[model samples]
Target: MALPSAVKVFLLTMNRSLGHVRQVEARPLPPRNELQQSVLVKTFEELFAELRQKAAERPEGSGTVAALDKGVHFIGKKVVEEAAESWMAAEHEGRERTAEEISQLLYQAQCLMIASGLDLEDVYRHL
Candidate 1:
């Protein structure tokens, strides 16, 4: 089965920080299912690689590949839009709804990362 897009998003965003979040008993992703740390680690790594491979394909004409090809400003607009939606969700709803919005925001950020040609490693190096 294909993984959910949100799972793929984490592969880009995950850093060493999550482990600390867990250990500290801080709720990193509230309203998320109680996904085991191991499951999250395994699935996210596999799915993230898959997304990167798809991006490398650079499909022509339409869809996500085409949207990304339109360049930075287009991608930036999407990121901004997603961010606003997420903020509104967090303010108005309970944890579950907020989680969904956050997922959308992360997925948009992943799109921007793909458009920038920056893999997770590039992000790590930058940080």
Candidate 2:
């Protein structure tokens, strides 16, 4: 049973005795610096800070609805403004601009969730 020359070559490459072993350059793993610049983390921090402030502004367990409504309303306003910016970007600039605007819009929406006493993690978990 004669094997093809390619098979013999492949077998030789797999063998530890082969002097023609492939050299794999050991590259340093990518740094986690990108996470420091993550928009998601930044947005979460901003949203949570505002949420805490709004919570602190709460009048000692009185009128939770009012607080929630105020927060939601403010977030809704931000969303609308962001949406407008996105639309303008889409019309005037390009996809890159529009994507940036949309990212801002998502951040605003996340703020709304926080303000409304909702956890973004919960949404992520459910999804």
Candidate 3:
């Protein structure tokens, strides 16, 4: 099945942030029976790479670009907002909702990292 428009946009934004010149196309999910055998997952390393590229390119109309343009303070506020939402979702929402909120939180946090000129290695060292 084709991805929903929202998902497509999200993927497109992600690809653009990664400095991909080509358009992103939605791919069908693996069959349910094969899910346990193989699943596609994007790692945090990939996300950091994308954020680094976004910091450099600053593409117009991209959320990552907007966040980066706003600088670290604004991005830090968003990170806090997403974190609060994630906590609330975990406390009061369903698993999927909680996951979604957490994903948002992570994205914002990554944006903050980019704004601050930090990378995965820096974070890993701190951790």
Candidate 4:
């Protein structure tokens, strides 16, 4: 069936107007609050416990400071795993996926800090 010339022109005009309206309303996005201090604390505690176990398992290292370094490798392993998960999430779509992946990454990082006898407060203090 052949369409009327007037109808075709009206449809084209409307499409053009909608494109312009969208362009005019386009703006930069604000930074999202993906993580917060309270969330960090909770995740940090969990990671810390894991780190403590790793450290206790390897008590061969001398003194407090020296022992801290022994578990660094273990923490490193966890961090690497978290990084891979985060990368996977980033490759996929959706805010929730990224959030969960980032949460894991943060948790592993906290584990590393805890292995070194550090805490969330220490990071905040340094910041």
Model 3 misplacement above 4 A: 1-40
Best by TM-score: 3
Candidate 3 per-residue lDDT over residues 92-116, each given as its tens digit: 8977999789888888988888778
Q: Which candidate do you rate higher for lDDT, 2 or 3? A: 3
lDDT scores of the candidates, listed in order: 0.65, 0.65, 0.78, 0.62
How well does each candidate superpose onto the true structure, as a TM-score? Answer: 0.59, 0.43, 0.67, 0.43
- Please provide, for model 1 over 6-118, each residue's C-alpha lDDT reduced to its tens digit, 9 standing for 90 to 100: 54433232236454322222224433355554345324345456656667786565466766778778988988988888877866887788877877666667777877877
The model with the greater TM-score, 2 or 3, is 3
Please identify which of the two predictions, 2 or 4, would achieve the higher lDDT against the true structure: 2
lDDT of 2 at 105: 84
Count steric clashes of candidate 4: 0
* lDDT, model 3, position 62: 87
| Cα RMSDs, all models | 10.9, 17.2, 15.3, 15.7
State the lDDT of candidate 2 residue by residue for 4-111, as single tens digits.
554443322333555555543333423457655653344455656655575567666644335466678776887899999997997698979997899788767766
Ranking by TM-score: 3, 1, 2, 4
Residue pairs with clashing backbones, model 2: none
Kindly list the per-residue Cα lDDT of model 4 for residues 2-91, writing each as its tens digit: 445543332222235346422222233223344453344344555566656665675565343353665779668878988988877865
